[model samples]
Target chain A: MEALYHVAPFTGYIYPNESVVPWTVLIVIYPYLTGLVAGAFTMSSLYQVFGMQRFKPVAHFAMLTSLCCMLIVPLPLLLHLGHAERALNPMITPHTTSAFAVFGYAAGFYVVLLLLENWFVFRPHIVQQAQQRKGLLGLFYRVLTLGSYDLSEKAMSYDRKWIFALAVVGIPGAHGLHGYVGFVFGSLKSREWWSSDLMPPIFLFSAIISGVSLLIVLYALSCKLRKVPIDLDCVKGMAYTLWGFMMFALMLEAVEFASLMYRGREGIEMILEYVKGPLVIPFWTVQLGICSLLPVLLLSFMIWQGTKGKTLIVGVVTCAMLVLVGVLMMRWNVVIGGQEISKTGKGLLTYHMPWVEQESGLTAAILLMAPFVLLAVAVRLFPPWEDGKAAH
Target chain B: MENKVEKLEEDGRRKFLRLFGAAIGGGGMAIAANSLLPEAAATETPAKAAIPAIPGYDWSQHHWAFGVDATKCIGCLRCVEACKVENNVAKDPNHFRTWVERYVTLEGEEKARIDSQQDPVNIAAAGAEGKYRFANRYKDAKVEKAFFVPKLCNHCTHPACVQVCPTGATYKTDDGVVVIDHTYCIGCQYCVQACPYGARFFNEEKRVTDKCTWCYHRITKGLNPACVEVCPVSARVFGDRNDKQSPISIFLRNNRVTVLKPESGNAPNVFYVGIDKEVG
Candidate 1:
């Protein structure tokens, strides 16, 4: 039952086991998706904690987006595992020293915190909606309330206090959630392509960038769908922040690469050959040229002297979409491109994503969209666009 | 009034003491609960129950290690064949518990030519007449030196694979061979990525990460590993490293030996004799 693909030809020596790359495109999606969760959560905090009143309309939407994405983050990981049932072992009996062991703890902590914060923010609204609805829908909202019927001013004030505390704690918790993913790649001393101290911070910054980009795109799409006017200030503010963070992330990556090149490390030549070989397309074209550079220019121009109406919205949306693709390309390069070069420095390994296989690229693409479907369901329940609807 | 105030102070001190005691007790219980979980989860397979003790030999008394004398290897690949038969490994060239590499370098050549006997499809195609053949792989007129270097899992004392396994699915045994508990493996492939020697592979058929176990099942029963037993030139050696009488110990003491990628600090149990610098 071998998947059909040409074994990538290799020159020089490669140990036999390395001929097939074990970590596939699904693993790439794991980190990329987790980054979005972290980044989007941070955007929500910009309004809740930092008091960025311009971001008010999108704050709840951003939090819901982050939660929806976070819920789906573990799916790709579970799908990639050879024995999915044993995934629970990490939570029950985690290997303390292993970097991956933190996945369970960090993800659990963040998910619970997000759920608590969501409850705090939406409790009063749920209580109100509960009274208006009937039958099963009313029962659903009632269950969600957990029998706390207090919609009083005092109860609302307490909820606000809790929300503030959770948001503050969540800032670093979000960083740890994504930063731990970076540590998994960075701690592997075996592969020279990933072994960098800069990987954690670099991942964190890119996460925030992609996250903000995703929010911008989603927000724009939502406005267009519901016939609501796009919040110009929100879009402009996010554009400026997105450009700044993307530049910082790009600089970090450049510095990391430059330092490695300057030192002429032992396995750097193999990676150089990889950059010349099959890696040229994703590494140079999609990740750097289209995704990174194009978005940077588009956003820079827009941020300097932003236009209003459809033109500004289109520009922001385009750049946001580009950055999203670019961030994902970066993840793909890190996970899959890193595996293309053999650790022995003698040759390259190749991978082709089979269309029909469960772990194939097609399946990964479908799995990536699952979160949006979940987000649709979440939107119905929480109504992230309520404020925007009222303004309209 | 003074007596009443003294009573109030006494009551506050008692409440404080009780809370402190409860906090310490709760903390102690949490620590105890944490330590006990991994112990319960570390249960070995029932296969260990069926393993018989070696006659008059205590398994705990000695440490095991492997050694390879590269100078003695003849590139016959009998060990590769034997290992597949013994372990029920797939017949595909991509799957191997042990494989042999041949390195050739002509005089005045700046680079060495290295080839491992993987890729069964090419091997079968070349030997269409039902006989194995390598068509003039070393046809250079100025051949300086050629040697066969057999490789397997080094079973390192400080194994990187074991260190990176998220669920502790891959672990080092007390007797020193690193083995994977296939049932428990999530197969995230982190262990495969961590291995510097590229000894680990995901078994496509079984859907689990597989590697050389140094024949733990056979060795514990006082039998040589399939590779060592089938080596016609005595190139592969396995024995108790603690015993001076063992062939591995004698070879290590007598020869200038090296392990692959010594800079990795894995402290491989497998030692190679007369190994070229080009070997991984």
Candidate 2:
């Protein structure tokens, strides 16, 4: 019979149980998905709440994207649990002190908020389809209408109020949920790498950049598929958002790293050693140099030169893709890297992620892609595109 | 001291009665109190009727503690084996309820070299995943200083594990032991990451976080933990700290003992003597 658990190989002295890393690749996916949800919601709110004209083209699409990502946000966590069925136990008998206990309630509230906001945003399209189409698809849209066929000026104004209200409330709700995800790691004093006051903000900023980057990529992809004229102003707006937030993310991360080194705490030697050796490629080269710095430099150059049209599109899209990879690497470094350094402060452990298993690389990859698949179906049904008319 | 014990028992009774009254009057209040005030949740006793009653064990009347004398330990591996057998812990080198560490300072070396039974060399020496033996790798090295430090869960007064358990499936008992309600645990392993000592592990078979409970079942029945009972050199000690004459009390009185990672603020109950600065 095979071993029930994958044992991490280590050097020096680690507690016997430390050989089996408690968290896995699935955890890396959890925060990444959450960040995308928050970022996408922020994009939608720019138009819905703040009334930013540049974001008008993608506002509804952004909401649909946020909802799709938010719906699948819990999958990685559920997959990681040993007792997935008992996942509700935390919500039912919450230990208030635990940062994790609040996750169920927060995620549930955000999911409901997303659904309500999505319903109001797509109501016009839903009403149109319900009146015109006939068949199973029509029945689905009618059921989705929730029996309110009122597209009157009064009803629309009321719906607009509700939409504005939900979007305003969602700004904090979405970001707070993601910031709390950072707190889950930062609050733990056990690991030197994770214990820092800067963690929450760092996570929030990185999340914003990642979400904006994802929007840039997705928006560009959708235009290509639909054969519609790409909205240059909308793309520029997202790029600016990504660039500004990326600066904060990079600075906060640098300060956090600098402080950790300056403190020269008990385990500094081991941390320094681990970073210099094992972290060279992942931390320095990929995440920092290529993914982070390259994108910032490219975006800065493009903005300075007043680049536009195809060049601007290519430049922004490339930077966004780099930022996306950079943020994923950030999540990996925080989650997996924190575990790699032994809690003993005297050793380091290497986690070998299995290619195929219950909570393996394959599962994580599939989960990362699952949201986009749902987004495709959601896009088809709701028709978030500004150019597309309802089926009537 | 006797007066103090009586006072504690009286306080315990009063608190229990208040909780019991609230429980009887409205289950919602107890649940509300539990979720709102973490101290109440931490100290809430397991319903007595739910457990199989021990003949005369009253958890409230006792407070347990453990002590380790590093100087006396022989690195025999007996305690490690005994703990696994007694607890039915996972029979593997990686999962241990209790294990011993060998810390050695070689000639002219500024730092000590450390390894435990889970080390690859030690596992190779033992020749089986279920067995444990420290390798004689240092036998050919220059003479210096060495000692074995036996380790287990501290069963801390402010256990980070219990504090971070999402479902309250793991908690500190009234008698001072931290245990998991295996059936209720979601096995997210947040507690495992929270532990500074790395004492907690996810039990694959049971699908819950497992750790050294200080052998709560056996200790409540007036028996020592398996590791303490089987230590040939009497390195491991266990007794109720509430008892003035208990072995742990005498050990505390006789030795200048310290806990692992004092800065962690865990207030670990596993007091140790003759451990070097590098032991943590």
Candidate 3:
């Protein structure tokens, strides 16, 4: 018979109940997906709100990415819950003091904002397709038109105004939603690893970098699939954004870690031991060294050399892919790593992730990929490419 | 220690609860007023309604506390077994409501070596996951100092677990016991992560977070907690501090007790005596 729970193996003297780790890899994916949504929205805002012409090509696509990612953000949490049906209890009678209680409202509000923004942005396309096409696909577009076929200059301007307003509101909405996720971990005074004032900002900065990086990769992939030329200027703009934010993310993380060590509180010794022994590969090697530092250096060199065309696209995409991995590792370090060091302050435990189970590594991998699947189908329906007919 | 101070604390807690209740009520009203459905206001809220009413228990009339005398603990494992049986806790080495830790400082060693009944060697000695025993691994070594300390939920005055519970399913009663309404808990385990003492754990069987409730059912029925009742050496102490003559009250008065992780600011209700500096 299968065991009811996975018991983490440990050393030293952890409280006996500490043997079973509470949050799993699924929890790690929760913040990662939310960060992507926030980050991608940041990219779209660069074009829609900030009026950065270079970002115009990918701005609509970024919004679509944010919406798709936001739609799937609740899955990991739902799957991790023991009674997923009762998940709305937090929203129904939210405990005002609890950080986790705000999630339902925050996520719900952001989803509505994203949906509204996407509708305004795509209404022109829906009207055009509704008039021109036939059969089931045409009916789908027609129904989506919401009974208004006005493509007048006045209506287009009205739609643009709504798009700009929603994007403006979404700046704080998206970032606040992700920052709140960081607060969920940071405000916990229990574990020395997560308790930090710097957590929210750090998560915010990392989210920006990860989202920009994701946009770079997705844009490049889409161009390849469509046999269109990759926009070097657009990719460069996103690369610069990624480079700038990655520095802030790296510095905040370093400062947080240094402060934790310098404070040298009661559990400092055990934390230091864990970092040197168990945290070597995950923290120092992947998160900091290869993924973070290497990407920053590569992007810097590309910018300095005035790199252009395929070389620049390859460089920017490479850095973006590395950053995506780096942010995921950061989430893993914050979520799973916090648990590995027991609250006892005298012990450490190793979380052995299950390969295939309800909340297993496989489930987490699938959840992470699910947004892209939706994004693919959504991009087909909406067609966010610049070469496609512009709605506004 | 005085009734006046206790009254002030209780009053303060009541004020906070009143404010919290008002905030929820006000928010619910606003939501209902904005909602399209007229019947939305009539839908029952799950959290406040879920608190089970005990027939004879007056929770507000008493202040409960627990005490652990480390010096008196013999590591007999009786309290551990009794707790599991009485509470129907999972019969496994990992899931324990109460367990004893043996801290042994060998001669010339700077730190004490610690292990509980869950240690693999001890489980091997006991011959089963459900059983409990402390392995005699240090018998050959020259021991300088050794002692056993029993551990359980502190039922903290400012419980991190209760504060972090999203659904307010876990809450502190007026009598000072932290209890969970299993029916309302969403099973997110945020409380389990928030607890600094590792007191909380996700009950896979129940599909909700679980911990030592100080045997709320037994205490309300005028019986000692199962572990306290089964403790052969009187290491585990339990009673209402409202009665000055109660075991916990007298125990607190007699001992220079300290709590685990005072820096965590949880202000744990569990008092410990004869514990070493490294006990936490």
Candidate 4:
């Protein structure tokens, strides 16, 4: 006797097993990653396209981090789905069922835009230098340039126009990526903690901080390792930007809490249960203490000293930790924190990250590390600094 | 002679290896295919065949639209066992087919226990103290009006899972059952997390979420849902909510029934009578 039968195919788009809580976790995490990509890229453009002198040296690192995080941006989302293979259909053949389809668009579009923008901006110098090196090194640059090796005066000018246009186009795509992510959570009518009017803006601000912090750290590390001179102005400039964005993100989160608590609605109890008890550690320790505060402190010290090597080292360490802790907390809070409340509102929901989960703890950590590994590899290969005047 | 023996031995070794590999590979493939393509032979018979759900598939109308005369329940666990078999829900403690929730409320001089699992079935809490101390099946109210209300998926009309699915891997059947396409599902747990009812489960082994599915297997075969069929008191009701003359339509007309999260706009198809305010 037949015990079971295969269910519907593509037509069965709803999750058969969904209870109320887990769905909210997914919508929140995806946007957080996209916001980081957008925020970081925007900082890069401030120097490269807008001609901010202090931000000039920070451009290459910004571009590199953006590339790193952008490629793996969809990892958490893909991990949550029980059927990973079917994850691609939204990207492959998009059918707009809901606003969520916008994520599908942002994912495909940004990969190309980032690659092209980075190529046009970096190609001329890369190709020129690659031509000087012989054998495999030269061949690597040649292949990278893809036969577009004209480094003439007009060619460089044309490259600038391309970068400007790509950056302009990228601004909206970046917003869409983060906005779409915010929309995922905001649209849910269920769970009060998730339903918020200010979600998207909060996402954007935090993402930018994550981005600039990544550059501050990366720039310092590159300088120290390569024994190059420190660029105080660039570090300070990015720090200022990071500080401004972090304040905004923190304020927005506060406002969200304020608005929800002001109503003292039925769901407020659930939110308080999370903010006070189980979530106190991750929220206060990692998010407030490590991710935001320590970096802000170091960056402030660097800003005050405004000196050469010392400022760079402090800023570098601070930036590295902020980028790592800030974003990781953002992911953790959204995924686990949102589910901390039960629909009953009588108690809390439980989620201990089990090993066998598709997005198991270890795999998630590795996916997040992909950016640094790629950055290290990119630096060894491309060396984003100018000839001998590398900024440590 | 030595060369010939060597060649013969090598050939023998190769054949043995080939047979061994084939056996292992064939066995593995069978297990893999079984999970991917579940068996349907039993469901193909005339009387037992799974029926294709027709549109206007309102679950509120199913013959098993659960209704409890709250006075009868005494916190037994029989219904939970009956439900697991009907749904083939995982018995792996992590998965629950049905569980009795017994609640006690004390107000001033009034004290009462409301265990939804009826007097005949509350195995887990049989010997425990409650309103109906000497009851198994609800013959009459024992202590100051304790009520029982069975809970399951509210099988929504505008299910959030159907809305958030990226790959169209989730959809509502014409009969209104929310079905999952495991093959097309990317194991993305979005739908699993999105469902407010927590009626969803990620079939961790298959990497696709699976949940109550309302026993679509039995329904199409013109049988009641697993929980409905096993009730000794004939309390479960199933019918076409869209059909004016259906039993559900008559039941709803005669009784006061309510749905979960009426504001969620998911349009739950499950209806409850003799309700609890905190059912959501």
Candidate 3 accuracy as lDDT:
0.88
Candidate 3, superposed: residue stretches over 4 Å from native? A389-392, B1-51
For model 1, residues A1-392, the per-residue Cα lDDT tens digits are 74622354466578877877778888989899899998998899998899998888789989988998999899888888888878897667566556776577678767877887898888887887788889999999988876566677976787787788778878988887788789889877788888889999989999999999999999988887778878898898898889889989999999988876787777777778888777678978998899999889877777667567778889988998999998998998899877877878777777776676768888799878988998888887888765536212
Model 3 TM-score (2 dp)? 0.92
Sorted by TM-score (best first), the order is: 2, 3, 1, 4
Query: Model 4 over residues A1-392: C-alpha lDDT tens digits?
Result: 32112222111011222222344333344555566688789888897667897877767667777877788777777765555667767655332443454465556667767887888777866788678888988888888876555677976787787688778767776765676566666655556777787877777777777666667767777777878776776776776787677778878888987898897866576577678876777877888778777776776676677645674666556665665577668756865666566554544655545343344556666666776787778766655675355432
Worst 10 residues of 2 chain B by lDDT: B24-33
Q: Tens-digit lDDT track for model 4 on B20-44? A: 5355434333322322221121111
| Global local distance difference test of model 1 | 0.79
Stretches > 4 Å off in candidate 2:
A1-3, A389-392, B1-52
lDDT of 1 at B234: 94
Candidate 2: give the clashing pairs.
none
What docking grade applies to model 2? acceptable
**Candidate 2 CA-lDDT value:** 0.88
- How does each model score on lDDT? 0.79, 0.88, 0.88, 0.61
Query: How well is each residue in B94-179 modelled by candidate 1, as lDDT tens digits?
Result: 66788888787889997777777764433754564222223456565688988889989998877778777777778776667788
